[model samples]
Target chain A: MTTHNKIDPLGPGYEGVAGKELRFRDVFRDTLRAEMNRDQDVFLMGEDISGGFDRDTKEPLDAWGGPFAATKGLVQEFGPERIRDAPISEAGFVGAAVGAALTGLRPVVDLMYFDFVTVAYDQLLSNAAKSRYMFGGQTRVPMTLFARSGAGTGHAAQHSESFYSMLAHIPGLKVVVPSDPYSVKGLLAAAIRDDDPVFLVNDKKLINLTGFVPDEDYVIELGKGRYMQRGDDVTLVGMSYTSVVCEQAAVQLADAGINAEVIDMMSLSPFDEDILLESVQKTNNVVIVDEDTPRASMASEFAAVIADKAFDHLDAPVKRVTGPHSPVPYNKGLENAFMPQPEDVVGTVRNMLGRD
Target chain B: MEISKEKLEWMYTTMYRIRRFEETMLEQTFKGNSMGVTHPSDGQEAPPTGVCAHLTDKDWIGSTHRGHGHCIAKGLDTHAMMAEIMGRATGQCGGKGGSMHIADFSKGMLGANAIVGASIPLAVGAALTAKYKGIENESVGVSFFGDGASSQGVLHESMNLASVWKLPVIFACENNGYAEATPAWYSVSAEDIASRADGYGMPGVVVDGMDVFEVYEAAGEAIARARAGEGPTFLELKTYRYHGHFHADDPKKYRKPDEEEHYHERDALKNFEKRVTGQKLMSAKKLKSIRDSIEQEMLDAVEFALESPMPDVEALYSDVYVNYSNPIFGLR
Candidate 1:
C-alpha cells in the first residue's frame, strides 16, 4: 500500500534500448550499483562478490567475486556488511535472504548456478514464495534470487538448466529472463525494487553480448512481454537464453521469405499470455523455442494454449523446438546437438511451410 | 516453582485451547467438515505453550505441518485460524493457505510450512535479519519441526549458518517419535537429533516435551543465548502426538492400541494440570470453568463456520498476486 513518487531505475526513461549497444555484463553491474546507490534497504548476499573492489592497496579486486561474476565490485561501494560472501551453502543464504526480506531489507541473493536452486528449494518455494500469503499478507518478501542459466560452458548436466518453467508453475513467484543487456539492466533494477520475490534469470551467453543502455535508472514492469521484432508470417515465443536462438531463427526465416514476429517473455509466472495470443492470432503460426525439455516445457504449455485458443487461425500445427528429455551431456557435440539451435528453428519453419 | 499462579493458569488455558481445538477438528474430520488434511497438535501443546512462554512478540517462530500449537502459542486468533481451516474469506491467509500453512507475520510467527525442515532456513534468515539490523537482544527466531525434519539437509545447513554468524535462533526439534507413519528410528539415522547439532558447533539439549517446565527451561537458555549473541541453540523436545498423523489419517494401522494410553500417562495436559493443582495455584472449579469457556469458544467457531457461506465463486482468483489484475486461471 506504500507508493514512492520517485522514478524507478527501469522506468520509461530507458525503454527500447538495445543489448548490442551496452554489454550485458556492464548492464548488470550498472543496475546493481544504481539500485544500491538509490535504496539503502537494498543489499547483496552471495559467494565472494568482492571481485573488482580496491582494497587498502592500489590494486583493484573484484568486490563480490563469485562464479557468475555478476556481483563483482559490490563490496567496495557498499562495504562487507551489505555485500556478504556466504559459505558453500545455498540453503542458508537463500533462507537468510527470505528472513531479511521479511524484516524490511531488500536482499538480492545470487545462486551462481541455476541448478543449485534445488538445494534451496525449501527456502525458495516454501518459505519465500508462501511467506506473504501464508502470513495473510502481513509481510512483504521483496527479495531477488539471481542466477546464471543455460548450457554454453561445459559445466555439464548439473550446472546448466532452463528451469524457469518449473519456477513459473509455482504461484507467488515472479520469474524474469532478460535476454539482452538492456533488459538485464532494467529487469535487475525492477527485481531489486519489486515488493515481491522475483527470480531474475541471466543467461551466460548473453552476459558478454553488448547493447545500448541509458545512464539513468529505469524499470521494465514484470509480466509485460517485449516484442523484440514485429512480423506477420509467424509468432515466435522465446524465454530465457533461448530468445537469442529465436532471434537468429527469425532472421533465417526472414531470408527464406517468412516474416516471424518474436516475443520475448520477460516474466514467466505472471506471464504475458495476452501479447502471446495477440501475436499468434496476427501471424496465424506459432513456434515456441525453449532450451528446457519439451515435456511440460514452457513451449508445450504455450503451444497448448495457442492450439486451444487460436486453432482456427493456424496455418499449420504449432511447432516446439526444445532440448530432448534427457540429462544435459558433458560432451560438447552431444550438448550442442541436444540443445535447440537456429538450424532446428529453420528446419521446423521449412517443414511447416512445405506442409502449407 | 518460580512460576506464578496466573502464568500457570494462562499456560494451562492455552494448552486447553489447543487440545479442544484439535478434538473439535478431529470430530469434524470424521464428519467430513474439513478439506485438505490436518496434522493435529492434540498432545504436544506444552512444547509450543511452554517454549512460547519465554518468547515475546519480537521473537520469531517457524513451525511444522502440525503447527496449530505453535500458532496459538504465538498469539494467533483462534477464530481466524478456524475460518482459514473452513476456507473462509475472513481467514488469516484470506483462505488461500489453510491448516498446515496458517501464519500471522505481525506476531512474528513467520509461518508453518508443510515441507519438512523448510522453516529452518527461514528462521535462520529472520534471525540473520535481526542481527543485520542490530535489533540483537530484542529479537530471536525459533524453528519448530518434528523428528522427521531433522533428516533434511537444509536443517543442518541452517544450523551451521546460524552458528557461524552467531545468529539469534533456536532450532526446536519436537521429536514426537514418528515422522508421519514411520517411527523416528526408521527415519532418523542419528542417535538423537540433538547430538547432530554438535557437528554445527552449537549447544544441543534434550528435554521432556510433555513437561512445560522442561521445554520452557530449555527454550529459555536457547533464547537467552541468542539474545546474548552466543549464536544458535538446538533443542530436541522428546514429545508425542496424541492423534494420527493428520485428521484424514488413521494411526490404527501404524500405532499399537495401548500406545495412546502409555503416552497419555505423560500427557502435557495432565502434567500441567497436576503441576498447577498440586501447588494449589488455582481452584479445580476455576480451572474447569476456563476449560468450559474454551470448549464453548471452539464450538462457537464451528457453528460460525457452518453457518457461514462458502466464499463467493467469483472470489476464487482474488489475492493471487498483488498490485496486478488477477487473471482468471479457471481454477475453482
Candidate 2:
C-alpha cells in the first residue's frame, strides 16, 4: 500500500464551508490527528492499528489505518511510537490503556468491535470505570475507549452490536454516540480531552455518512443533546446513527401532515434529561429510536423517564422503536429486519398518533 | 549485590511494619473496628518489599487483593492505610476503597485489584507511558500478583506484549501456594509460574520469597534490566500465607494441620531477623527498638482511624467524574 500524503484539512482554505464535507471516518481520523498534535500526551494503541507488519523484515510495510481506516495515515505522520499495534489481546491492551491513563498519557484504545468488549469487560469495568472513584478523587483515568457499535455491515453478532446501553449503565463512564460526521469530530475531540473515562461508540452503519465538519478544533459538550429539526406534533429521540433514521422518519411524518421534532441524543450516560423532558412536555407524544435490543435499552430508559416525570403531560403512551431482543442475524434479510428502520420509527410514531 | 547495613535495616523495618500491620488489622477486625474483609499478606512480605526496593516514586506498581504488604513497602502512609481499612474519610482511598482497593497515586501505587491478574496489563500500560514519554529507561512498571493470577490469560498476554514491545515492565508473581481455597498444585498446569515466562521470550527466575536478600538480589537484576530497556521479566517468588485467604476464611478445612506450623517455622520476618542478627549485621537491641517503634506507629494509626469522621453523605455523588455531575437515582 502506498502512503497517502497528509492534507491539512484545517488549513486557511478549509474552514466551515457548506459543500466541504468529510466522511465519518475522515472526520474521526482528522480529529485524532489534531488531538495528537495538540497534546503530546495522546497516543493510539490496538490490534493491527499500525498495520502491515512484515515478520521477516521486522518492519511495518503499511498501516491498514485500523479496521475501518478511521486511523489511516496516522502511523506515517506520528510514527509507530504513537500509533502502536498490539496482539489480539483486548484485556492486555485496554487494561494497559487504563494504566497508561493513570500515569499521565491519554491513550485512545480501540475495541475493534463493541461485541468484542466482553473479552475485556473486566478491565474496562473493574479498572477503568472504578479507578477514579475507588482512588478517592485523587486520580483520573482520562482514557478514550473507541469502538464501533450497531449492526448492518453483515459482520455477524460477534462483530456487530450496539452495547452502549450496557456501558451507559456504568457510573464513572461518559458514553458518547455522535450521529454524523460533524458531531463525531467534535464529540471525539471532547472525549479525548475529557478528564474521565469516555466510551465513544461509533456506529458501523454511519461510517460512510458525510456532513459539514469544521476544519478548526471544536468540542461538543458531553450530556448535551442537539435538535436536528424542530416541530410540535411529536418528539422523536434517536441515538448514534439512528438519528439519521429519525430525521428521515420526521420528514415522512411531515409529509403526512404530522409535525415531528427530531432530537439527537449525542451523549448517553449523563443523558440530557432536561432536553428530553422539555421535548416530551412540548409534543406530549414521543417515540425513542435506538439500535440496541429492547430490554434494558436506552430507548427503554427514555420511555421510563417520560412515564415517571412527564406522565401527567403525555397525550399518549411513550412509544419505543428498538432492535429485536436477539443476536444480530448473519443473513441479509434477517439482519435488515432485526435493525430499527425509518419505517419502524414512522410506524411507531403514526400508531402513537392514532393515524395507523 | 552486597546490601548495606542501612538498606538491610530499612528492609527489615518495612517487612516488620507489614507483619505488624496485618496482625493488628486481624485483631481490629475481630474487635469490629475495621469493616469489610482483608486478605492479609502476613507471611508474604518479602516479594513486594524486595521488588519495590528497586523502584522509586517515578516507577509504578500494580497490586493484587492481598496488597497491604505491597502498599506498605511502596512507602504509603501507614496512618492513611489504617484509616482506609477502618472506612474513615481520612483513609488512603477516602474511605471509598476499603482494604482491597487501597490506592495512592501520588506514590505510584496504582491501586490493588480484586480481580485476579487484572493489574498485569495495567502495569504494562504504565510502562508503555514511560516508554512513550521517552523517560530514558529511568522508570519501570511493576505488577505484583499471586500464583493463582498467573493462570489468568491476561498474564501471558501481558508477558508477550511486554516482550514484543520491549516495554519496561516486571511481572512479579508471589506463588503463595493457594488461590483462595484451591491449591496451586491443582489449579496451575505448570510446575513453576516463572517457567511460563520462557514461552513468552523473557527471563523467568524463581526465588525463595521467605528470604528478603535472595528476593532483593533477583529483583534488582530484573529491575536494572528493565530500566536499561532490556524488556520485561517474569519473577516468581515462592512464599506462604500463614493466615486464611481473608479475615473470615478457615484455612484448617483446606490444608493439613501441620502445614501452618511448618510455614510458621520459616516465617519471612523471623527468618530474616535470625539471619541478620546471627551474622552480626545488626544487634538484637537495634531490632527490638525498630519493632517497638513500628508497634507504636501502628497503634497511632489505629487511633487516628477511630477518631476520624466518616465521609459526608454528599461525598457519595462526587468523584464519579472529574467535571460531570453524577446524580444518584431517587436522591435528586
Candidate 3:
C-alpha cells in the first residue's frame, strides 16, 4: 500500500464490452485454456490435476478435474504432457516450476489449497519470489500459481486459508484475489501473462457462484483495484469473498441511507492506492473487511494506508472488520463467526455513521 | 568415455579452473575483499567438470552452496564470478546475490542456491522444460548438491518426480564426506546416497570423485541416458573438500589431520597429472602450461574483482519485477 505506483485501474474498453454469464470455476479454467492455446510454452503442474490414470489403458483420468474442478477437461484438450499431474511434492514441483520459468517455459501450478503453501514455502520464497531480484534480472520467473482459499466449506482449519498479505508481503511476488467470475477471468488472465511470479487465490465459496463475464479476451492490470459500487458516505473495502460481503453490506446500508462505496481489491501487492485514497478522500469514512485474521491482515494494511496518507481527510478513525486472531474453527457457528460477515460490515458502518 | 585431445584439455582446464577459483576466492575472502561468507569448493572439482563437460549453454544446471566449481565448469566468466564474490557492480548478479547466489542464465547455470536441497527441483524443472518441449536431447539438467542436501526432502521428491515423468535430469550428489563439519556417515540415512535412487526407480552409480577420468566416464553415460529420454540418473561422487565449510570456519576443530592428509595424498589434480603424463596422453610440460595459464587467469580475476566499482544505490530498487509500477513502497 505504501507503493506510490499507480495504474489506470484498466477500466477502459469495457464500454459495451459483450459478455456471457459464467461460473467462477469455469472462467478460471477458460483463462488457463486460453493462455495455453495462446502460448505453446504454457503448461500445468499439480497433484491430481489429471487425477489418476486408468491402469489398463494408461490414459489419464481427469478424475478431480483440478482443485474444485477449476481446471476440468483441460488435460483432455491439452493432453497429460501439457496439463501435467505432479506428485504431492509442493516444494519439489514449485522449485521445478521456478526452474522451468527461468529456462524458457510458462508453468501454471495449481497448489490445491493455500494452507498447503507452507509445504512449498521455501521454493516460492527462496527461488520464485527472489530469483529475479537476487539474480539481477538475469531471469524472469513467468509462472502463475493459484489455489483454493477461504474457510466456508466445513473444510475446517488446514484446508482453508485466505492469507493474501502473506504472499503480498514478499517483494517480487504478485498477489491477486478475484471476487467473482468476471474478476477471476480478468485477474487470472493478467496473472498468467504477467512475467513475474503471481499467486491468484480462489475462494472455494466463489467457485460455484456465477457472474457476468465479457466474452472478449481481456486482462485486468496487475496492482489495480476496481470500484464495484460507487457511493458517498463510507468506503467498504474487501478482497476475494469479502468483496461479495461488502457488496451485500452496501445494499443493506443503502436501505438505511448509508451510501457505502465498495472496493474489490483484485490485486494485493502493488495494490491500487489511488482508488483507496480517492474513495477515502470522498467518503471521509472507511471500513475494511478481510477473512484473514485481524493482526497484520489486508484489512489492517488498508487501514494503515488511509491513516498514513489521508489522516486529515478521515472524518472518523478507519475501522477494520476482520476475522479474530485465531485458527479457523470447525463448528458451523464458530466458522461463520470467524470471518467478516455482511452483517458485521453493515453493523460497523451503522456504528461509524451513528445510525445505531 | 573416449577422450579426444580437445576434450581432455577441457577436462583438465575446467578442473584446474575450479580448483584455482575456489582457492583464490578463499584467499580473497581471508584478505577481506569478499563481502560475506564463501563456501570454497577447492577439492571438489571433478564432478562438475565431468558433468558440465557433457553440457552446453543449451543444457541447465542447479548448483549448491559450495558452487564455484559448478560455475567454472558451466563456463561462467571468471571475472564476473570473482566480482560477484567481492560484491561489485560488475558481478554476475550485480552484487545483489553475492557469494551464495551467483547465477548466469545465458550459461544455463540456474544458480548456486544458499539453501540446502533447494536447487534440486530447479534442475528437475529445467529437465521438465526440455521434456515438455520435446528437446531432451539438446537440453538436460544436472543438480550438483552436497551430502548435507542429500537428506533434504525435496531431493527425494525431485527424484520421484523425475523418475515418474522420465525427465532428463542427473542427480549429482557431491559426497565430500562432510555437511558443514558433520560427517555424511553420521547424517545420511543410507550407506550410499545413490542407493536411494533404487526406491525412485533409476540407475544409480557411485564414482571416485577425486579422479577426473572416472567422473567424466560416469557422468557421460548418465548424461547420455538422460538425453536418450531414459529418465534420471543418480551419481554419488565420493569426494572431499580441502577447506572448511566457510572462509572463517576451522576444520581442525572438528576434523583430524590424518583425514585431511589422506584426501590430499589422493589429490585429484596430482593423480590426474601423474596418470596423464605416465600414460603419455599429455606431457608434463603441457600440464604445467595449463596450470600456469590458470594461475594467471586467477590473478587476473582477482584484480578484476578488486578494481571493479561497487553497485550504485539505485540498484537497491531494480530487478524485483519486470514491470512493477512501484517496487519501492513509501508514503505518497
Per DockQ, the best of the predicted structures is 3
Error of 1 at A169 (Å): 1.9
Provide fnat values for all models in the order shown: 0.55, 0.85, 0.88
Off by over 4 Å in 2: A1-19, B329-332
lDDT of 2 at A30: 84
| TM-score top scorer | 3
What is candidate 3's lDDT per residue for B190-262, written digit by digit as tens? 9988998999999899999988889999999999999999999999999999999998899999899999999
For candidate 1, give the lDDT of residue B19: 91
- Superposition TM-score, candidate 1 onto the true structure: 0.90
**Model 2 clashing residue pairs (backbone):** none
TM-score of chain A of each: 0.90, 0.94, 0.96
> What stretches of model 1 exceed 4 Å from their correct place?
A1-20, A51-64, A132-139, A250-258, A354-356, B248-262, B324-326
Q: What is the TM-score of each predicted model, taking all chains together?
A: 0.90, 0.96, 0.97
Q: Which 10-residue span in candidate 3 chain A carries the lowest summed lDDT?
A: A1-10
Error of model 1, residue A328, in angstroms: 2.4
Name the better of 1 and 3 by TM-score: 3
Please name the candidate that would achieve the greatest lDDT relative to the true structure.
3
Between candidates 1 and 3, which one is better according to DockQ?
3
Give DockQ per model, in order.
Answer: 0.48, 0.82, 0.86
* Backbone N/Cα/C clashes per model: 33, 0, 0
Model 3 agreement with the true structure over A1-356: per-residue lDDT tens digits: 01212323332224575887888778888889998999999999998898989999999999988877777899999999999898899998999999999988999999999998999999999999999998888889999999898888899889888877888888899899989887887787788888999998888999889988888787778888888888999999989999999999999999998888888888898788888999999999999999998888888888888899999999899999988888889999999999889999999999888999
